[model samples]
Target: MPSAFLLIGIPGIENGATWTSLVFCVLYVLAILGNSALLYIIKTEESLHTPMFFFLSLLALNDLAFCSSTVPKTLGIFWMNGGLIDATSCLTQMFFVHCLSVIESGILTAMAYDRFVAICSPLRYSSVLTYSLLRKIALAILLRAIALIFPIPLLVRQLQYCGDNIVLHTYCDHMAVVNVACGDKRVDNVYGLVMSLFVTGFDLLFIGLSYSMILQAIFKMPTKDARQKAVGTCGSHISIIFIAYFSAIFSFLTYRFGQKTIPHSVHILSSNMFILFLPFWNPLVYGVKTKKIRQRVQRILFYNQSTFPPSRH
Candidate 1:
C-alpha cells in the first residue's frame, strides 16, 4: 500500500489495460537484472578497476535506483484498478526520484572531470585518481546528491493538498504533486527550475569541454590506431550522454516551459521518455565499451559455476 494517491485522468483507481501492465512488468525485470549485472561485472573484474569504470558502476547503481523509485509503483498502478497510494508513499517516491536525479547529475559531472584529468593531465592520471581517492570522490557524489535533493522533498512534505489529488502522471513527481497544493507553489516551481537547469546544464557544458580536449588529444597522437581507439572509447559515452540529456531536457521543458495547450498525454509521454530511455541505454553503453567489465563478467560466471558444480552423476 502506497501512501500517496495519483490524480491521473483515469479518474479514481481505474485499472489500466492488461498489455500495458505486462509491458511495465517486463521492463522492470530487465531494468533490475541489467543494472545488477553491471554491478557484478565491475566488482568482479580487477582489470576494470579504473576511474571510468568506477563512475560507470556508480551510474549503474543510480540507474537501478532511478528505475526502482518509480517503475514498481507504475507497474502497480497498471496492475491494480484504482491504484491507491498513501500520502507517505507518494512522498517517498518523490524523494527517491530527486535523490537519483541529483546523483545522476553528479556522476556525469565527475565523469567529465575524469575525462578532463585523463586527457589534460595524462601524466598525473594515476596519482590523481588512485583507488582511495576514487572512493572519496564517489562518496562525494553520493553526499552531494543527497544534500541537493533533501530540500525539495522537505519543501514538498510541508505543503497541504486541498483535494486535487488526480496526478496526471502515473508516478509521483515534485512538480506534479506541488501543482496540486492549495498553498503557494510559485516558490517551489522556481526552485525546481533552478535546480534542474543548474545541475543538468552545468554537467552538459563540462562534458562538452571534456570532449573538446579529448578530440585535440586524439588529433595530436602519432598513430591512427591510437586515435581510433580513443574515439571508439568515447563513442558509446557520447551516444548515451546525448540520449540521457535529450530526454531530460524534453521533460524539463514540458514541465517548465510548455503551455497548458500541450495536454496531459504529452507530459506523460515526456516523463516516460525520461524514465525509460536512460536506464535502458546506459547499461548497454558502458558495458559494451568497457573491456574490463566484459572480462570480469566472464570470470564471475566462470567462478560461480566452479564454486557450485552441477548435480550431475
Candidate 2:
C-alpha cells in the first residue's frame, strides 16, 4: 500500500481549476458566514428557542462541519496543487465526508418530523419535542452515522492499491478511492451501496411521509387562511429539503449510473455542488422564508438607526 494518494481534481479541466477554486472559495465564505449568522441568531434570540429553531441550529452546525470537511482540501488541490493526502488522512476524510452527510440527512429528517408535529399535532408539539428528546435525537443521529460509516473506512483500508494512487475527485471520496484499488472489491461495493440506500432511502422516505401528513393536515383545515399559513410555515423547510436531496440524488445517480454518458468534469462538479449547495442556500432560504428570522436579521442590521434627526444637527 502506498503511503499517500494523489487527487487529480476535476479531470480534463486542469487549466480552469484556478477559476473554479475562486467560485468555490466564494461559496465557502458565504456558507460559513450564513450558517454562523444562523447559529448566532438562534443562540441569542430567546424567542427563537423552540424545537424548530433548535433543529435549525443543529443543521447550521452540521453545515459548518460538512462544508469544512472537504472545501479546504478542495481549495488546496485546486489552488496550491496540494493533492497528496496520506492514506490514513484520506480514509479519515472519507469517513467524515460520508458520516457528516448521513448526519445532515438525519437532521433534515428530524426537521421534517418537527414540522409534522408542529402542523399535524400542534397541541402536543411542546410535550412531544422536548429539549431532552431533541438531545436524544441528536445523539442518536451522531451514533447512527458513526455506526454506519465507521466500517466504510475500515473496509477501504483493507484493500491493497497496487495500481494508480490518484483519486479522480477533489477529496477522498469513498467510491473514488475504492475504485483505485487493484483487487477484489465486491464487499466494499456492496457495503457502500447498502449504506447509501439505507441512509438516503430511509431518510427520504420518512421526510416524504412527514410532508404527506403535513399536507393532509393543512388541507383538512377549514379556513383558507389557516391552510395558507400552514403551507407558508413549511415552505422554507420544503425548499431546503428539495435542495439537499435533489443535489444528493443527482450526484449519486450520476456517479453510479451516468459515468459513461456524463462527462467526468460534470460529475465532479455535480459532486462538489452536492457538498456545497445546501450549506450556501440553507440560511438564505430560512432567512428569507421564515418571518421571525427575517425580522430578527433586520433588527440586528438596523437596530441603531433612529427615526428622528439628531438634536445636535
Candidate 3:
C-alpha cells in the first residue's frame, strides 16, 4: 500500500487553477441545491408519490452521492493543492464513484422499464410497480453495483505502488490508480473493461428496447393528444438518460482511446466536466420539462403571490 497518492490537476493548464476551481465550485453548489430541492419537493408533494417520482428521488440522491465522491476532492486539489490522498481514502472514493455510476445506470434502466409498462399496459402499471416491488428493485440495483465493483479496490490494493504516485486525473479513477501500480494489472484491466461494457452497454441496450416498445405503444393510441401525453410523460427522463450517458460515454471513450488525438488536459477536463455536468444539469432538466415539478417549484418560489394586492377585487 502507498502512503499517499498525488493527483495532478488538469495537466498543462497550471495557470487555469482558479478558473477551473471556480467552475467546479459553481457546479457543486448548483448540483447540491437543485438535487436537494427536488428531493424535498418529491417527499412533500403527495401528487408525486407515484413510482416514477419515487425512482426520480432515488436518482437525485444517487446524483448527489456520485458528485459528492469526486467534486469535493477535486475542489480540494484545485484550490488548496490537496492532491495527496491516502490509499484507504482513495479506494473509498473509487468505490462510491463507480458504484453510484452503476446505480445511476440501473436506475435509468428501471425508469425506462417503468415508462414501458405505463405506456404498454396502463391498466396493470399500478399493480405491477407496487412499493414492495420498488424496494426490491432498489435493493437489486444497489447489490448489483456493489457486487460487480467490489473487486476493483481489492485488486488494486494487492499491487505495489513503487513508481510515481502521482495520478493524472483530478480524482482517484480506478484505471488511473491501477496504471500507476507496480504489479500485474491484467486482471484489473480485463475486469474494468467487462464491467464498463456490462453496466453501460447492457443498461443502454435495455433502455433503448424499452423506449422502442414505448414508442410503438404511443403510436398505436388513437388520438394525437394521447400520443403527445404519453411522450410528454417520458420527456424529462429521456433527457436525463441521454445527458448522463453521453457524458459518461464520452469520458470513458476519451480515457480509453483518446490519448493520441485529444490533448491530455482536454481529456482530463472533459472527464471532470462529465462528472459535474450530469448532476448539475439533472435537476434543471427535470424541473423544466416535468410540468408538475415546474408548477410546484413556481408555487414554492412565489408562495406569497396569491395574497398580493393584485386582488383589488
Model 3, range 1-313, lDDT digits (tens) per residue?
7778898788888887888799899999999999999999999889999999989999899989988989988898887889899879999999988888899899999999999999999999999999999999999999999999899999989987676788888998998898898888899988998899989989999999999999999989999999999989899888888888887887788778887898888877877877788889888888888888988988887987766677566
Candidate 2 per-residue lDDT, tens place, 125-208, comes to 999999899999999999999999999999998998886898999999988999899989999999988898888889999999
Residue-wise C-alpha lDDT for candidate 1, range 198-304, written one tens digit per residue: 88877888888888888888899898897788788778777877787887887788776684756666676567657765777788777777776666667777888
| Candidate 2 worst ten-residue window by lDDT | 301-310
Top TM-score: which candidate number?
2
Best by lDDT: 2
Error of 3 at 131 (Å): 0.5
Runs in model 2 with CA error above 4 Å?
Answer: 304-313
- Runs in model 1 with CA error above 4 Å? 1-4, 7-17, 259-261, 295-313
Q: Rank the candidates by TM-score, best first.
A: 2, 3, 1
Work out how many backbone clashes candidate 3 has: 0
Better-scoring candidate (TM-score), 1 or 3: 3
Q: List the residue pairs that clash in candidate 3.
A: none
